[model samples]
Target: MSGLADQGMLDLGPESLEYRMIGPRPDQAPTLVMLHEGLGCVGMWGDFPDRLAAATGCGVFVYSRKGYGKSSKATLPRPLHYMHDEARESLPRLLDAIGFQRGILVGHSDGASIAAIYAGSHQDHRVRGLVLIAPHFICEDVTAESIAQAHDAYDNGDLRARLQKYHADVDNAFRGWADVWLGNDFRQWDISEELAYIRVPILIVQGEDDQYGTVRQIEIAQEECYCPVDVALLPGVKHNPAREAPEVTLRHVSDFVTRILQGHEAAASAA
Candidate 1:
């Protein structure tokens, strides 16, 4: 693979993150910047980014955060406000580094929260929309319990071995996510306020049977986001909707992207 369909390390001074570009580069077309789940890395996304790019005819950019995949190790005992800092500090640098011209922020789980915060905090006109999959806007009992179970699995079961295939530092990747959500300080971790300030449209794709979060998450987006908030709650599905049910998830995301981009194009022509 060469040209736009290549993988490389992106240097951001403090960190050198791993990333993949699918289909067109950001300069050539609208882009889809995918943010992975809590225990997810660029590699864990598998070929979903490729499928998305093919379906939408947009550039797809996916990257591992500092601690996940082959990226740099995270600072030990990650700060309680790590997600906030990521949205406010790290994400902006990444967008600027990539020369993100116009695109939708496609995020899953923890990635979805960061995308919400970024969209709310920055009025970057280049960001046209958001496609949030299995996003959690607020803490819940189910979330804590699920995370605790995940930790147990990692320690006592084959979960660690499974994750090792993707992360260079598996412990760092799991610890950074597990410690935060399972920590007492995370109980009130809510980004509902951030959703309110988002200026663009949002498509919240969730699973009805998601083990990590509840329907309240979707409700939170509906209540807090002032902009148009579309939803797709898939029956008999789980937390990882895109991977668990690619056909449905991809259709929702692609249609959302197409609709929003077309609207933006029309608006631009009129302006």
Candidate 2:
């Protein structure tokens, strides 16, 4: 598969972030901004963004946060509120830099939390909706355990070798995310209250067997958010729905994007 046709690094003063844009005439459609997993980077997303663009007829924008992928190296011991920082600070700048007029945030794992935070905190009208895959509204024991297992995998398994292919500073990428999640202070990290403030439609997709978080995360969004919420719990899938269940994930996301765009068009016409 061909890589993103338009790709580059953006200098955001203190740090530089790598980004990729996809789809035919990206400016024409609503942009789907993809936020990768905790240890993920632009390269790790592979062809998923392209697939999403093809399926939804929407522009796809993906970027690597500082310290991941080919982006600038980050300082060690990431703050407990790193996701918060991304949502509150970095995301807005990136969107402005990209000239994003219409957008839907599609985030996975750690990325999902950032998306939810951005939606709730910024309340940016340009962001029409959200697609959260295996998001963590509140920290859980399972999440900590899963991070511990990941640490073990990086130490004793082939996980590091695999991840090295995508990250420039592999240790920074792993330790940066692991250190924060495993920290005692991070246990209380919760974004449930933030969800209540999100006004746009949201789609929550999680695997039934996901080891990191349970359906409670979804329940929190459903219970808290006043806006419409759609969910899909894949029977045999795991945390990475895009990879674990591509077809199903694509169909649901594409359909959701279409509906959102259609509604936007209808509203414009009504006005």
Candidate 3:
């Protein structure tokens, strides 16, 4: 709930991205970066990152991409290349400015997709790995239906009011995200081709009952990626696995990263 420091800013020339950094453990490996969902902000993560940092003893960076949370609002209609722009341009700049050499990305929903794109694309191999929760690849009928329902809930239901507690500029956040998703040009939004370039180890987590996306999304990602990828489908869970199944999510992430870290040590010993 702290301001300014709890929510920091990253300069991106004309645009400044909003972010929060916690868990300054100096000795930890592969700093954990928490990437929020499409309509999420630091507040919206709801202490999950903090709890995760404590559990893993790693540095944590939680940030809202431009036009969301307390970050700079988009002045023009977001181009169809929004996610691509974030992954190819803005995310690298943010990490460079923050001086993160290597880190494990943990992202949910849209954030997860963006993280995957970045890890898959980075030439320097700075992204050690990824933990994706309910990520999207290609736009699907199920995604469209869920977004339509979200638009309705935002306009008529109490979703707007509920979302306000998490975002400072709630209207801007909701409208910016909703307008783009429902826009005609966005119907073809897909990242499958972009994701094919990813070669780092990945952990994909999804809910059996997720209303927002189909299992095919994760399945496609696992099948297409040219790297080690693991999938977990939580039973009876909804879209937000971090909230609905925190311990389960944490354990999966912790164990996967632990195994990777151990593998790194074993390789070092062999060498």
Clashes of each: 0, 0, 1
Q: Put down candidate 1 lDDT per residue, 226-259, tens digits, no spaces.
A: 8999999999999998888999899999999999
Q: Estimate, for each residue in 89-160, the C-alpha lDDT of model 2 and write its tens digit.
A: 999988887778887999999999999999999869999999999999998999999999999999999999
Residue 249 shift from truth in candidate 3, angstroms? 0.8
Pairs with steric clashes in candidate 3: 120-198
Top TM-score model: 1
Q: Where does candidate 2 clash, by residue pair?
A: none
TM-scores of the models, in the order given:
0.97, 0.96, 0.92
Off by over 4 Å in 1: 1-5
Off by over 4 Å in 2: 1-5, 24-26
lDDT of 3 by residue, 153-235 (tens): 99899999898877767878877777787788777887787667886788999999998888998878867888888998999
Q: How far is 88's C-alpha from truth in model 3 (Å)? A: 1.0
With candidate 3 superimposed using the best TM-score fit, by how many Å does residue 125's alpha carbon deviate from the native?
Answer: 1.6
Give the clash total for candidate 3: 1
Model 3 misplacement above 4 A? 1-7, 25-29, 268-270
lDDT of 2 at 232: 91
Provide the overall lDDT of each model, using Cα atoms, as 2-decimal numbers. 0.92, 0.91, 0.79
